[model samples]
Target: MGLLTNLKDSVSRVTDRLFASEDPKRIGIYGPPNAGKTTLANRIARDWTGDAIGPESHVPHETRRARRKEGVDIERNGQSVTIDIVDTPGVATKVDYKEFLDHDIEKDDAIRRSREATEGVAEAMHWLREDVDGVIYVLDSTTDPFTQVNTMLIGIIESRDLPVLIFANKIDLDQADIDRVADAFPEHETVPLSALEGDNMDEVYDKIAEYFA
Candidate 1:
């Protein structure tokens, strides 16, 4: 990491530690479609609550509505925090039934999915305004980090003044470049992990216990 990057991360961590609260917080799992938002949510829920929030699929817009797993108590080495995990629908600028058709979805189902996905986007934004304490923004590290979805999401999170911890998910992939994501958003903390393979999951638990506890 560059000196500037290192400095920003250091400052952010110190700030989080200084503001750490005792009460449980509602932390949303947010990101663009197919970026492992649901995967990460389920992993955290499974470990802390013995349950999964929602299902995940390679097909986009699988989660058309928000799913909540309440009272997830994450404890590590005596440090712990209880959180309500809200696994929201994927935020996307556009949703087309044709895209689903490309995945071999039936026409009727595709249309319904597209409609629900569009509604889901609006609902996710609503939660940001009404119901959230902190957020875990999951990003696909294998793709370009400088996209409209990512930029807009970061801006919204900043505008809300939320404590965000960005996860550079899918690091097990050969093309993943976590540094690009970290450089793109220097103000927040970024931890690289593969939720599918369960790599570096311990760090995720530790971060939640540290920052959210």
Candidate 2:
């Protein structure tokens, strides 16, 4: 048993080193639905690579697929890191078609959207387990931070030993609270920003370079 444990540890170290040395680390942008994750991802991709990852919508589960933009070279204060930005679908414990119906979506479309969103969430988890090197966990600052889905996702990320930066998005709103989000995840660094208004993006870029690198 001791010898087997040692072998596993050695393999883990080698895997870590290999991933660390690779260029353009894969960084996943993850959060709940309607958290402005796609907005932030579009901002980053446009700023550096002159591209967009996906469309944004006010409705929940708008992003029902994981989108990727490769070779985005982000530089801040002379620190730089090349990364493949993966904007993943929202991680949710429960997705109901009724939520889509509330958005005035028709029955058939709402049900289909719910199914796709659920599959997307599963795909996002798969990426975290096998593909992503780091995580950018976004949260809506206007909402309560203590959620079962949020806790479960963060715990999964921690278990995989992935470096994560929590983003408190939609700070332009009057009800947005950065401190609450920070308090929710005291172990991880949280950055307050309005992804829609392009506020405090420099800090985000700098932190990404610092943490993910």
Candidate 3:
């Protein structure tokens, strides 16, 4: 009996390995500036892969390019899914150099940052159109969820029939309202969590395993 159990366990391990070796799904993290997309991406990457995707910043467009961390394995309830995380620039209809000026950035650098941010938005859209297998749409729970950018982006994702998981981030704040975010997109699942505080991450992981896998 011991020998048989060991053999079965070995086969199960091999099966898990084979499934893990399959092509990883590409999940793009999208949201407006200061919505904590990079924060969440860094959290996910660190939890599984012991790495950071990008730096967090109070300045808008801090992540002026799409940063990708490949092969992150998230496991929950004995289920697992491997994904390539693409941390993208915040999607905004307009990016002005003057906005960075509020952060005390130099004029020349702010202008360059604005240009790069615009380009980054374009790149993010291109990836959504051609590469992304799933989406994690982060939103600031304290803010209104019915912005034009959010509507347009969600519409685009819906049009493509890509799977999406909406994250109502920053629940640690007193003003955070997860229900408001959920009600904005009643058709999809909305998860409430504070990525910075690492609150309710278990649900996030379980949902990722369930939806993206």
Candidate 4:
């Protein structure tokens, strides 16, 4: 079966057998390294909801384990909807752990070890297909959104047939070009916004509500 069909079947089974009124929605934020995945997550967590993304900028792979913040509510069309935003690790092409061999680290350095493994972009794709209810694919508007990494990520999301919202973040930067970024996801939906400055965030929230509605 197709990925979308599989997801629908999974959701259907859950709805049929589990708590009927649960209505728990999972929102996943995905992007390549330094594309502002955590920044956008913090923006949504702070402005829309009281939840916050823990301060982990200097810590490598902080989001690799799927950090979740609960109790997010968005006021759409005069109604309130609860949401849970999951801040995931930055997806990127694979890197060799052999690169770290010369660092003179012991085998017990689990933190450093785990970082080397998650450097692969495929790991994020695996997580998305497994646990995501919807995706906000953050695009670096300052750079080429059609780059190999971004394109591959979008293709995987499409293959899953999941509802994806393209967030053209960093639009406030000098190099940003929202128009070009929007063009990258012509097949999926797109929203241009500056996640850092909180510009156009309401538009993002509205898009999210419509996707699940």
Question: Across residues 7-47, which tens digit of lDDT does each residue of candidate 3 receive?
Answer: 76457645655675469889999989999999999999999
Q: How would the candidate models be sorted by lDDT, starting from the highest?
A: 3, 2, 1, 4
- lDDT string for model 4 (1-213, tens) is 377965775586445434534565778888876677888888888887766785545333445556687768878999776777888777767644454445554545644655644743455666687877778888778888877878877787878877778888887888999888777776666788887788898888888776643
Model 2, span 1-213: residue lDDT tens: 277865775576456655777677799999999999999999999999898999999998999999999999998777567899999999899999999998889999999999999999999989989999899999999999999999999999999988789999999999999999999998788999999999999999988877666
**Model 4 TM-score, all chains together:** 0.75
lDDT of 1 by residue, 1-213 (tens): 588977776688678666857656889889999999999998988887788888889999999999888889888897657888899999999999999998989999999999999999999999988798888999999988788988998898899988788999999999999999999898778999999999999999888776565
TM-score of each: 0.89, 0.89, 0.90, 0.75
Tell me which of candidates 1 and 4 scores higher on lDDT. Answer: 1
List lDDT for all candidates, in order: 0.88, 0.91, 0.92, 0.72
Question: Ten consecutive residues with minimal summed lDDT in candidate 1?
Answer: 16-25
Candidate 2 pairs with clashing backbones: none
Every model's Cα RMSD, please? 3.0, 6.0, 8.2, 6.7
